[model samples]
Target: MTNSPVASPAQTAHSTGSICEFQPVIDELRRALNSTLKGKSEAVELVIACLLARGHLLLEDLPGLGKTTLAKALAMSVGGRFARVQCTPDLLPTDVTGFSIFNQKTREFEFIEGPVFSEVLLADEINRATPRTQSSLFEAMAERQVTIDKMTHRLTPSFFVIATQNPVDSHGAYPLPEAQLDRFAMKLTFGYPDRASELEMLAENIGAADRDRSPLPAILTPNSLQHLQDHVAGVHIQESVLRYLVDLGTATRHHRDVTLGLSPRGLLTWQRVAQARAHLRGRDFVTPDDIQDVAAPVLQVRLSGDFESPQTIIETVLNDVEVPVCS
Candidate 1:
């Protein structure tokens, strides 16, 4: 969970302007997400940072909390090809990775791709699927490719999976294995909307002629999103801040409440997310504040232990850890 070493903000700006130029895309995404997702600006911003960092996300919450809507809106806002697969026990691996069919005209087999071929995939009710079917996404998520009959098919450049699961019930659901959970960059919960936001949702539904009609639109292209990812990678992280990140990760490992701490991959993801957060704020270099802002979301799922609520546990851990001051 430690942060990596990066250049200072001044040094990064002096070296290049790529980070500065990518701000508009982040701004547009922020605005679009804010419009559709009222009263959840922090969650929306974290989701955008995950995308800009080329990381997958897991939205864990109860049913009908706008999880699917948010995923669809994010895919559309990035102008990426979006597909949704309702995960069920009967779903097969081939249903997601596609299968080869005999072509009479060509005298050979042709592979008909599946929903996984899309740029952004929404795996709704992911826990409802059998472990066999759930394991099917492992290859695509970790390697960005699907292997079928010894043939490997690479995914789109901006391939991202936003998976959703209902946390309240596990009666007929198969919990994601720890290994699979680790593949996700971050996990977030969309709690119930406040009174005012709930009222707005009711009002909006009252006037809508059809349920299919939604106001969200494509705001940014895939190419631009890829560029933004690159820009985030180039953002500066000072040595002191990097050490602070390292200290936090180390603390998690030694914390009495934590049975498991973040891995090196988790640490790298934490750093990347922090950099992306800084870029979203129109900063070329990352600050400790950026690390602190992103730490809870990026590391929450990575920490393991007995706690009343994982989110609350992470918040408590963050509050207990003393943030190192930088000169």
Candidate 2:
């Protein structure tokens, strides 16, 4: 994956004082999603934060968990072009990144864009695809560009992928390698809804032929979202907080239960996610709590350990690390 010249988000944000101006837009986007994805406030907020952070997501859960609905609602709320790719064992790399087609009359090869070209792409049952097919997303996810036949095609600036996998069925699934896993900023699971929410869903469905078929209002355009991402880059981080973050990363590396530790890329993404979370809460600077709040989702995707689950390991790291004093 080759990187092309684009305006640096950090530089653009620094040119302005801070990202406080975009708070209203962020809040509105959150509310729009919240209204549709009921009873999953935390999941919705994290999904929004992941977008603002300019990182991909991995959703691991059972079927009928509304993962697809969440992805659709997000795309609708942002007013971005949405595409879905149903991963299968026979899916080819060319099918995902696109291939050049021969034009008979013109005697020229034309490029056909794949689903990945869209602003929002949902890779459903990603693990069901073969490893060869799965590797197709690495470049697109990391550099936002895909090289086909030595020609590189750039994806939209706001391109985001939400890949989902069924946790229960691993028989025919290919486990995502560490490299592929590292590309995702966070991995989350949306569990079953609470009794009250389920009851509401049932009651509403009983009266109507189709339940909750209302369309989600588009609150932000692609350009507006990119601007918000740039603004999020301006959120502040104190020196003490930086050191504290480093300490947590280093601790993950040396933890007894872990086979693999958080990579530098993971650490950087973790910081960006924390900043985004702070921005969502209407703050310009990140706090230790902000980092803590996002640790489980961020670290769970990257950390591999033998002693306990990733979430438990992350929580232990949080408890052991001293929170930096912020003025």
Best by TM-score: 2
lDDT scores of the candidates, listed in order: 0.81, 0.85
Residue range with the least summed lDDT across 10 consecutive positions in model 2: 1-10
Candidate 2 lDDT over 43-137, as tens digits, reads: 98899899999999999999888887778888987778889999999899988899999999999999999889988999999999999888888
Residue 311 displacement in candidate 1 (angstroms): 4.2
Cα RMSDs, all models: 6.1, 6.2
Clash count, one per candidate:
0, 0
TM-score of each: 0.89, 0.92
* Model 2: residue 122 alpha-carbon error in angstroms: 0.6
What does candidate 1's lDDT look like per residue over 236-259, in tens digits? 888888888887788787777788
Residue 241 displacement in candidate 1 (angstroms):
1.2
**Candidate 2 runs further than 4 Å off:** 1-20, 207-214
Model 1 scores a C-alpha lDDT of 0.81
